[model samples]
Target: MTRTELQTLPERAVELLGGEPDDTTLRRYLHGLAGVDAVGLGQRAADLGTRSIKTTSKAWALDRIIELIDLTTLEGADTPGKVRSLVAKALNPDASDPTCPRVAAVCVYGDMVPHAVAALGAAHGDPDDGGVSVAAVATAFPSGRASLAIKLADTAEAVAAGADEIDMVIDRGAFLAGRYGQVFDQIAQVKQACRRADGSYASLKVILETGELTTYDNVKRASWLAILAGGDFIKTSTGKVQPAATLPVTLLMLEVVRDWHAATGEKIGVKPAGGIRTSKDAIKYLVTVAETVGEEWLQPHLFRFGASSLLNDVLLQRQKLRTGHYTGADYVTID
Candidate 1:
């Protein structure tokens, strides 16, 4: 599709969802989503995890996984210097090998968006040149305990600062308390706030923090809620919570996106963030995507890994594949 046609996707999805649903309608839509069978879901994910990938296939997986990495750093000690370094790393993950592909994006806290944008511009010369995007975590990230006003302001600040993407955490307390409409409204408002002063809007990734949601059924519900509320992507975690992204959680999310596409004909993205630290683990998630959703979802636009260490591991594996010998940690740059 052309750029004009692609830009109209969000408008079409919003129209299909009825332009801001009411509480009753939202609750009905939430209730209508089918529940997932925990046992069956776990069994299938485990079986997929066992699939063997080697040699040439492993090389292909490494390249694709490199492109899908968000290259994240969400710490209390983040600084402009740190963000610049991260941006440089994202632009050239493996400087020794020029053929190495750049990462999908560099993710940081909201206040660091501009630093990332500036750094990326210095590296690539144009902010929209499309070498790599800058993603900011907003909406009271990780905890999601703040008020909606503060959350929306946070989102706006990130987008106004030139973030290409916004990763917002959902209000888990409201969701677990059975306030589905409240959660839906919050996501919708955040989605709206992503619109910049110019007519353009950053892509929105709604993080469910699945570890705290406590059940597969809740993950399914949260997935549908985020998609219906205009989230371009549904993410698995904040990486702060203990049990961040798991095969089963990500698998179920893939199923949710697959089903949503089947119903609406609008494709949504899936990001399995947090705790996915190895190239092997990253490949398993890719395998899950290919087997469960189809190879179409394997691209960065449709899939992502919200990870920092994952890039290093993928680079190390790439080097090993190139030389037929494993390289030491000193070979790759430390984040």
Candidate 2:
């Protein structure tokens, strides 16, 4: 349905539903949403994001998200060969030579984008290559702690060096202290800096470190704030915090995405990063989206996992099903 059609929905379902969604009701709702009235319900939840009203399901969606994981890390280990090997391992954990389920991306620090770019460029030589794109963690990376001048410079550098996408962390201190303008302004500038070499822009994924925020309401608030401030995607955690991207936090974020899309007539993506580590975990996340947002969000564009070890498990599981027995650990590489 169009955004205009979403105009009459209640402004805040959390308040209407009385005290927000609890775990049991939320899980039942998310899990059972598929064949029921979720389109209208999900649309309502999605609309809340437009109203800047925070609404979240009671059960944390992390467990479900863990099942649809994206194994990721930003380090490149200091060399091109290492970079290529990492990508290779993620692509072909069983040494299948040239095929594997596409990983979300091979996340790398800004300086390493050149190495990743060169490697990916060569891999693209073969049309069927499963090479992952280079996703640079920019805007001063995990901390979001830097001068705007330096942050923008860092973002530009990552893109200039050929980052396929850019993940910029919002200034947590600013956002936490209610300095939404500063945080939003920084994200906007960084997005601008991430323009493609051809003058287009790399997709912008904003990281909202949920652990730093004191409550679920704040997490929801941060989610909309990022979107309104121009984030193409809203992500959980920087993997530097104690609670880094949990099920509850992810559920809250998903609700934010759903609500935002319902209200603005704009589609935004969701990425749950940090700590996901298995195929079962990844699939559950897929289920959550399918249940919470519907099948339209099943594609990589709207949904993804940010993980590193999770791919190895996904490969192992696929291999196990393809063959008839368990594969030895040596054939797969998580490190």
Candidate 2 weakest lDDT stretch, 10 residues: 51-60
**Alpha-carbon error at 318 in model 1, in Å?**
1.0
Error of 2 at 9 (Å): 24
lDDT, candidate 2, 1-335, per-residue tens = 32121212223323322333343332333333222233554554344322210132211222223233344556535566777776665444556734444454677788877866676665522112434566778877788888999988888888888776788999888766666657756776777787666666677889998888776666776776676556778899778786876655666677777876775556777888877776544554555566566657755556778877776666656666456674433221111
**Model 1 weakest 10-residue run by lDDT:** 326-335
Question: Where in model 1 is the C-alpha error above 4 Å?
Answer: 1-20, 52-56, 122-130, 326-335
With a 3 Å backbone cut-off (N, CA, C), the pairs that clash in candidate 1 are none
Top lDDT model: 1
Candidate 1 lDDT over residue span 3-108, tens digit each: 2233454565456556546556656666776778889999999888766443236667788888888999899999999999998899889999999888888999
Q: Could you estimate the TM-score for every candidate?
A: 0.89, 0.73
Report lDDT per candidate.
0.83, 0.62
